[model samples]
Target chain A: MKLINKRNFISIVCIFFTLITCGKLLYERALNFTDRYYTDNIFTILGFSVLITLILSLHFYLQKFPFWLVIIAQYALTVGIVFLAIFIHGRFSTNAPTAYWDMFVSITIPFLIGALVYYICFFVQIKRANKVLEKLNSEE
Target chain B: MKLIKTREENLEENYLELHYDKIDEETNAVLDRLRDTLRYIEGTYEDKKVTIALTDIFYIETVDRKTFAYTKDMSVEIKEALKDILEEYSKIGFVRISKSVIVNIFKIKKLQGDINMRVIIFLKNDEKLIMNRSYKNDFYKRLNDLKGRSAK
Candidate 1:
């Protein structure tokens, strides 16, 4: 599997951008922040998106292993990258330990949502393929 | 194109012929399927030559430069290259799913999606084949085309 191809890169960016935007909206609504706000660190978000894309592309390389193992590895890599990014941006030094926990929760929520969406799409595609297969088999 | 048929008493064999001004993609597909309909290859099993019908083959795989055709009950070593077989039978539902494996779409009982965009093919004979990620798109497209053809 070739990683970081144009098609996959575009897909990753789209999914990541949508997930981030929705997450931001949910966060603002929960906090009662009425004003439309965006993150100031555009580079951070872009860099994080690229890194996440690379990490997710690892799934193709590790396909020979069990599905559960691949999921666990991807999730762990995602969490690690998120925390590493936070640390590098100097947020770790200024925030309390509880703030780190909040960050972890934030990371986990979006990751879980992305995973769920992926699985749903994958299963739906498989179901359609199976239906076609059944029809073909019966025809024979 | 014109349709013509004739019934003859005590005919020894049946024959079909086509006369066309030019061959297009659709015409080529029809010709290939016509060729595939009566296709058979000589294979070796237990040091004996066996005539294997193309329709009875579930899949073909090449291992260490030796190509083998697998049927529901037996495997036979064939002299034909995988590439030639696919070129001849692709219009009849044979598709390459990996570097070394060509599977008969009609022989596939079902398909399951594996992690990382790979596909697991379940054959009617209770065997499994993993479709490579690179070939997944072509496989799906071919399968969809076959489905449309069947619907028609």
Candidate 2:
């Protein structure tokens, strides 16, 4: 399907980057405020970004997948990324919560936040698209 | 261009009569253009033949080697191949976004694209289609053409 417009794609990618970067900075600030500083190794940061970039690239490339499936897979990736970050910071067995409840909260919280951001972006795009469609219809 | 109106009580249904002397190639072409705009495509749907206006169709898809023209509520299999559909309506906003589908750009409601260069097209009727990367450029080119004309 040629449903993806190049201009829209480029714009979405730019927005996603901005959102993630801002999210990371705020998260770090919150951590510092709480005196629970998560170690930020340069290599670990690089790896995390790389893995996410690759997964998102794959998700976009496989555009035939249904929206729900994509969401599920993305949530799963979010869990995996959180685990990776915990492991890399060497706090998996130390500062981290080991109970199932804690783990569940950790994963679901970020997943919900991520989902919210995604849906917000989706709705914004929809509104923009509706305006564009209106223009196109007027021209017709 | 000129018009001459006359009241004729014998006319039953508002008859239109054209009076021209020494009609040239240009006039002949104009007649063809008028016919093309009012054209209907004869097709078959569910084993029954139907005629539909070309502009009313949302898109055309070739499934299982058979081509189908889809409107808001029905799908009619047309005798014309995919290539024929492209040749016929592309100039009027029909665009090929995949190997098997030619969507009317005017019918698309939303277009979202991601980093992988894939696009999701949302139709006004709520149907969604992914614009494969392979045909992405063509879709954009046609879209840009529409934008250009609109700008003018």
* Candidate 1 stretches greater than 4 Å from native: A1-4, A7-11, A34-43, A91-93, A96-99, B1-32, B112-120, B130-135
Name the 10 consecutive residues with the lowest summed lDDT in model 2 chain B: B29-38
Q: Model 2: per-residue lDDT, tens digit, A1-140?
A: 33335545555545545555566568769886542433433333344444544455555465566555776797687667667656655554454455334444645664577667866765565455556567888765
Q: What's the CA error at residue A86 for candidate 2, in Å?
A: 5.4
Per residue, candidate 1 scores C-alpha lDDT tens digits across B36-134 of 766888999889999988888999999999999999988999999999998878878899998899999989988888655567899989999998766
List the candidate 2 regions with Cα displacement exceeding 4 Å.
Answer: A1-40, A81-114, A135-140, B1-53, B70-76, B79-88, B96-101, B107-148
**Model 2 agreement with the true structure over B1-152: per-residue lDDT tens digits:** 45467788877765556678977786776566556545789998888889998777888899999999899899999989989878877766788988899998888877876543357788877888877655765776677676675675
Best by lDDT: 1
TM-score (chain A only) for the predictions, listed in order: 0.72, 0.50
Q: What local lDDT score does residue B2 receive in model 1, on the 0 to 100 scale?
A: 51
